[model samples]
Target: MKVICILCDEAFTPSKFQARKIMKHPHKIQICETCHDRITTKVNMQRTAKP
Candidate 1:
């Protein structure tokens, strides 16, 4: 299937194995190269802040 990397902002075609790899990650991830970094960085920063 064709999935864009949400972090690198680069489109890609991931095989079944690759898709499985991404899905196995702990973080909440969605295939979208156009906005992966934005989502990850924003979420991480929010999560790391002192409550």
Candidate 2:
């Protein structure tokens, strides 16, 4: 199934299993792996930043 990333708006097709997982959370925002990874990296960096 096709889904657009809520963060970057990039459109792509997810595997059947992924589609089912996303659908299971009807109210959760959907973000592509790229955005997810980027956000995670940024957050981790901030957490480890010098004060």
Candidate 3:
């Protein structure tokens, strides 16, 4: 099924396997790989940064 990234608004299609998993959470917004990676990096940086 087709999905759009909530963060970057990018459109993409998920595999049948992924689609099933995603459908399990109908209320949750989907995020693309690019945005997911970017967010993950930012979070990791924050966690590792010196206070």
Clashing residue pairs in candidate 1 (N, C-alpha, C atoms within 3 angstroms): 4-33, 5-33, 6-32, 6-36, 7-36, 7-37, 9-33
Question: How many backbone clashes can be found in candidate 1?
Answer: 7
Kindly indicate the candidate among 1 and 2 with the higher TM-score: 2
Cα lDDT tens digits for candidate 3, 1-51: 789988778898877876997989878787877888899999999999968
Error of 1 at 17 (Å): 5.7
lDDT of 2 at 13: 79
lDDT of 1 by residue, 1-51 (tens): 566565566678766776887678737555664375677899999999959
Candidate 3 segments exceeding 4 Å error: none
Q: TM-score per candidate, in order?
A: 0.36, 0.74, 0.78
Candidate 1 at 32: error in angstroms? 2.4
Candidate 2 achieves a global lDDT of 0.85
Q: What would you estimate as the lDDT of candidate 3?
A: 0.84
The clash numbers for all candidates, in the given order, read: 7, 0, 0
Which candidate do you rate higher for TM-score, 2 or 3?
A: 3
Error in Å for residue 10 of model 2: 1.2
CA lDDT of each prediction against the hidden true structure: 0.68, 0.85, 0.84
